[model samples]
Target: MKTPVVALLTDFGTRDWYVGSIRGVILVRCPRAQLLDITHEVPPQDVVAGAFTLAGAAPWFPRGTVFVAVVDPGVGSDRSLLAARADGRYFVGPDNGLLALALANAKRYAAVRLTNRR
Candidate 1:
């Protein structure tokens, strides 16, 4: 397969290193992975805004883009991480009801909860 390109969408701004940290992790995991940031100011804790931003920008990326949506309020908690492969793209984030509404437009290929991973 070709090198994967990951698009990052987060509420964390550029002033901080949170976004950088995520990028670093991806770099280490997939040395050839390409990283792209959709936006950092996602109206903090606003799932609706993040959903809107994701929907609008996602269609523009090339097929197989790994989209990381992180407008997570309950991240790393009871909230389950979700990976949705739609049309030819992959999405990772919390299953906090933000995607179900917007995913109506894309073709859902697969969906699984992170909790199921052992």
Candidate 2:
């Protein structure tokens, strides 16, 4: 099987351990996955900026790349988590419009609310 590419985007800056923690979780779960950092510099809780940045960067990546964006200000609330496939790539993120622009540009796409926490 081809090695999976997982890209991460977040408002969590590099000065702290958040980025490392996220990377550690991914590595623990999928040791062979190739991880890329899109950017962790989106303004804090700025969903629109996150959306714009993600849309801009999504096209440059290869098909089958998975993007994980974490820019939600509504974390731990009722907002849904989403897993979406758009333009042949995958996106996993909060359903707070951060993934909207990217999904909009896709010729074909599908999204689902992720209810399974385990």
Candidate 3:
């Protein structure tokens, strides 16, 4: 079995515990999963920057990489979260254009609103 690569991109600066806590949770669930930080300096809540950065970095990663982007300004609102597959990579993030650029040029892509909290 191959270890899964989970790439994280967020505006959560390293000065806080947010990034570390996210890593901890991922590690706890998938002990062998490899975590890579695409970036954590996305100019807080700037979804456009996040989208651009993610799209730029995404193509360089190997296929099967899963990206988690967290640059949503509408965090606690009724905004929907999305789980998307573009080309062969996966993306999970708020449906606020953060994942749009990355998925735009994909030859094959699909997305679903993540409504089930379980």
Candidate 4:
């Protein structure tokens, strides 16, 4: 059984509590989750950069790894959250095409636009 990894890619730099706060929440929920930082230095509000960063690195992780990506400008907007499974890995992020390239390259893919938020 492969280890469960949670890879994070965000535009939020390490100047504030954003990245650390998120990591705390994830650890609370998934204590055993291996956290990997794809990059927290993505250009601010650059979804294309996030997309490229994630797509480029995702294939290197073991299957079943979960990717949690948050790019800028649409963090708390009404934009739908996405849960995507591609090439045996899972991705959770905004629906701003950050997962586009990876999903396109996947032999098996499925994506859901989250509608229910409570």
Best by TM-score: 2
Specify the highest-lDDT model's number.
2
How much is 49 displaced in model 3, in angstroms? 0.5
List TM-score per model, in order. Answer: 0.91, 0.97, 0.96, 0.94
Q: lDDT for model 1, please.
A: 0.84
- Model 3 TM-score on a 0 to 1 scale: 0.96
- Candidate 2 Cα RMSD (Å): 0.8
| lDDT of each residue in 36-93, candidate 2, tens digit only | 9999999999999999999999999999999999999987688889999998999999
The C-alpha RMSD in Å for every predicted model, in order, reads 1.7, 0.8, 0.9, 1.3
Clashing pairs in 4: none
Per-residue lDDT of model 1, residues 1-76, tens digit only: 7988899999888998899999998999899998999999998889989988898888899998999888878866
Give a tens-digit lDDT track for model 4, residues 1-92: 45589999999999999999999999988888889999999999999988999989999999889999999586788999989999889999
Ten residues in sequence with the least summed lDDT for candidate 3: 72-81
Instruction: Show where candidate 2 strays beyond 4 Å.
Output: none
Query: What TM-score does model 2 achieve against the real structure?
Result: 0.97
Against the unseen true structure, what C-alpha lDDT does each candidate score?
A: 0.84, 0.96, 0.94, 0.91
Give per-residue lDDT, candidate 4, residue 113. 91
Which digits, one per residue and each the tens of the lDDT, describe model 3 over residues 25-62? Answer: 99999999999999999998999999999999998988
Error of model 1, residue 30, in angstroms: 0.3
